[model samples]
Target: MNASRKLTLAAAALALTVGGGLAVSSASAEPAAASRSLVTTTAWAKVAANGQILGGQGITGINKFGIGRYNIGTAAGLNGCALLGTINTNGGNDPGPGSSSILVGQVNGNTLFIRTATPSAAGSAAVDSDRPFSITVVCP
Candidate 1:
């Protein structure tokens, strides 16, 4: 993994996440959810038909069916609203529809989907590589 790939959250937010705690004030406790920003990309590690990593490219946007957030690593933010998970599939790779890529962050909370695309340099697979790939999360 990229060591420099640090999340851009502030110290308080980082602490809240690490401590598995939530700071919901009376105002935040009201019937409402925060407007979360999704962090999705289409540049992921390339995987084989059996879900093996062959190579990869840069990520782009969130998947078309990015849903819900999961707490695979943190607990301070929304219960199902963070983009922190990993998925192991490419768009239209299965017989039906999902690649079944897993993700982090809780669903319906602050979750986000990250889709990656293959690089143009990878020959033969380049066409297939340009497809959308899903990422669940690689929690920090």
Candidate 2:
């Protein structure tokens, strides 16, 4: 099978597994009645195009509903700019049971958004975040 077909099939499988209980908490809407599951991935240290390793820290974990947080700990590499985020299951393809993680309150400056699945108005599910997320800097 082609890459596109494989991605589509993986997405479909994720949708069927997560179901409707998973949702991204919107600013205007109230938090969903159902609680969310938290998950964490392996940490990524500061890596640059050059051979130098700048000071940086990362915490990969899904907060609620598959919405993950990749927090950057150090300030050296962060230039008031945008970054990319991706998510996947622990097995890299299977969205099954996993561990949980979260913070009490306050949106920290380094906190970034990562979602495992997106819901459509027609009731269909769009699976985006699934196992290993590749996060990078779009700007300097």
Candidate 3:
């Protein structure tokens, strides 16, 4: 299949999964509410190109090592978590224009490493660039 088709399918699946989870959680009663503490395992962060933390939940600190490189500290360890991130091109709290890409990974149990890049003029390679981004991490 083509990349567009694969991306479409993946997005649809994610939407369904998130929608279903929200439905199930919202429908549960008091007993289930007690177990909702487990939901705290999810964390998120919005950071600027200068590594300033704009807003986030369960995020402790954000450090900029250099251009296009950052380390995010979380309130809890993320030993077995799924990390997702995307560049922020929308102008607002985190303002930036043009297209960019981001890469997120776990550097340690409680730290996540992020790298940002922009496509080269020839569109043949990616060059490291400073860009704002948002990230989400879900741990089990």
TM-score of 1: 0.20
True lDDT of residue 31, candidate 1: 28
Point out the worst 10-residue segment of candidate 2 by lDDT.
Answer: 47-56
C-alpha lDDT score of every prediction, in listed order: 0.35, 0.37, 0.76
Those runs of model 2 whose alpha carbons end farther than 4 Å from true positions after fitting are: 1-79, 87-107, 118-131
Best model per TM-score? 3
Question: Can you tell me which runs of candidate 3 are displaced by over 4 Å?
Answer: 1-41, 90-98, 121-126
lDDT of 2 by residue, 1-140 (tens): 87765665565567678873333243322324765755333234332212122333454332333333223332323445445443323244434334322222213554444333333212232333233344444333
Tens digits of per-residue lDDT for model 1, 1-140: 33222322243367677885444443433223567765543233443333333554333223333122211212223333224333343554532232233323334433332333333334454322223233333322
Ranking by TM-score: 3, 2, 1
Q: Native-vs-model 2 lDDT?
A: 0.37
For model 1, the superposed segments whose C-alpha errors exceed 4 Å read 1-43, 57-92, 97-101, 105-133, 136-140
Lowest-sum lDDT 10-residue window in model 1: 66-75
